[model samples]
Target: MSLPVNIDEYSRLVVLDDNELQAQNVAVSVRERLQRLRGIYAYWLQFPSKFDKEIVDYDMKKFKVGRAQAYDDLHLTQILMGNLQQASKEFMRWKINRDLEEDLRLARQRGDLRAAASIEKNRIMNNRTDKDDEPELEFDKIVPQQFEMTDDPTVIGIQKVPGLRDRIRKLEKKYGDTKIEDADYEEIKEEHDGNGTGS
Candidate 1:
């Protein structure tokens, strides 16, 4: 018997192929094409019905199906298209989450301990209610003048002072040797001798 040109007839034709391998191959090809067509149909359904005839004509040509077959095919195609779209959206969300987790793991393994801790803290904070804790000030807000310019001579002369040997010697003697009474050499020697410690 000849295959029916309609979708219902096409299904019957699938059952009649004598070569099982050929039938399976055709079925796989048709199903794959049908999935792609469904995706297109999902997008097309977003358009107004005034373009129905245009859409139908386009599908018939695109799928190489007869007019009668195209009519029923469009409906089934639309249902599959909707499902595929949802699946695609869900897959994208899952993929994004997986990628973020991988990046976090790599950051931790690379000794970026602060970054790993921040990620974990963010995740924990995100799961809590707004009232759970007070919001902490952001780094930029806490130190608003961090990047601002200063006119202090100490700031301007910082680079120049390092190269001045005389100034460094004077500053070092004045500041570096200014020790507390508790840090006197005699007190240190007495403590060390009493403890019978050798340096």
Candidate 2:
């Protein structure tokens, strides 16, 4: 005799996959598209008379909403901008921390005493920044991070370097751990002796 199969589970999966799941995915895609469109519209709206007929037509046709929706779009844009700013700041911080970590690992692997020390110090400072919940500059106020966009942009976040005293302290600690000769040590210190304005 053949055993009875639990056809209910199989039927549920097939039906959900074909219709409910597809509909949900489509709805999500539409929402995301609208969100992107709104952001683009808002960015252009930053300047007066920047809205061309094409943009207007796109909004009317794609969004299927009245021109009065600009008010809502503007409000949503402000919220989106604020979120984007926070996300960018967070991304920058993460990127700096990750880069320092990778640099430290590579320095150690290469036995580059001075480089390893400096990177370790930077990593420590990054950890401190995270723990301290450091305040970030306004998104637009920050200079763009120098990194390839194709790489891990989010993890390789942006950050301003710490002040001279802080950097010097870290450098001093890092230098103590290295086994460079006395002359080399002095040279390394000299090289790092810049007013702590560079990263």
Candidate 3:
């Protein structure tokens, strides 16, 4: 297809080419030009008589055309500026709507319809929770307890008197000194008892 000449059309072309960088650059240029055009219109509106002649002269120089041609160019530029302004407004609205929809979806997922409605209504402003507004719970409160026991001494000890060493074998297995052979024990005992004389 043939390429377009209008700024908006050219921006769409850049976007459709799948070159985001080029598209963004074109959009920035278009936005700057649109802002400049709007400013000119505002100034002309405020001081029509003072600006009209200069605007016509500038247009004539820019397009290298006659007075009628300059008028046509200015009309077309105004129309394009209006369209750009509407497009920008629509883009902003779309972004806000999309964000609200996502927030509602998340709130629904978390089972909070009130939160979803608040978000939709734009009532949920602050993200931080107030300490005073939060509910107070007795987290440190303690409850009384009773216990029963069975024939197993280990279970009985644990239930009746917690932390009692219920099994000597298990305790020894865990942290006692290493077991000594009979010969090693006798040699150690003899040295300790001072029964060993100078060799």
TM-score of each: 0.24, 0.27, 0.26
- For model 1, how does the per-residue alpha-carbon lDDT over 98-174 read when each residue is reduced to its tens digit? 66577789988899988888766654444443346656323222222235676445765655445577787789988
Residue 140 local lDDT, model 1 = 23
Residue-wise lDDT of candidate 2 within 27-120, one digit each (tens)?
A: 5543543454454556555643343334445555666654434333333444433444445556877999888878878988998999988877
Model 1, residue 149: displacement in angstroms? 94
Clashes of 1: 0
lDDT value, candidate 1, whole model? 0.54
Better of 1 and 2 by TM-score: 2
Model 3 per-residue lDDT tens digits across residues 1-199: 1122376663344324325535556566445434444444565565544444576566666546555444544444555544344355567667777788789899999999899888867623332222345563222232324456655565635454454456765798787877865663343333343565733
List runs of model 2 lying over 4 Å from the truth.
1-41, 44-82, 127-131, 134-199
> Among these predicted structures, which one has the highest lDDT?
1
Worst 10 residues of 2 by lDDT: 1-10
Local distance difference test scores for all models: 0.54, 0.53, 0.53
> Which residue pairs show collisions in model 2?
91-157, 92-157, 92-158, 95-155, 95-156, 95-157
Cα-lDDT of candidate 3: 0.53
Please give the RMSD of candidate 3 to the true structure: 32.1
| CA RMSD per model (angstroms) | 35.0, 37.2, 32.1
Which runs in model 1 stand beyond 4 Å of their true positions?
1-26, 39-51, 81-199
TM-score of 3: 0.26
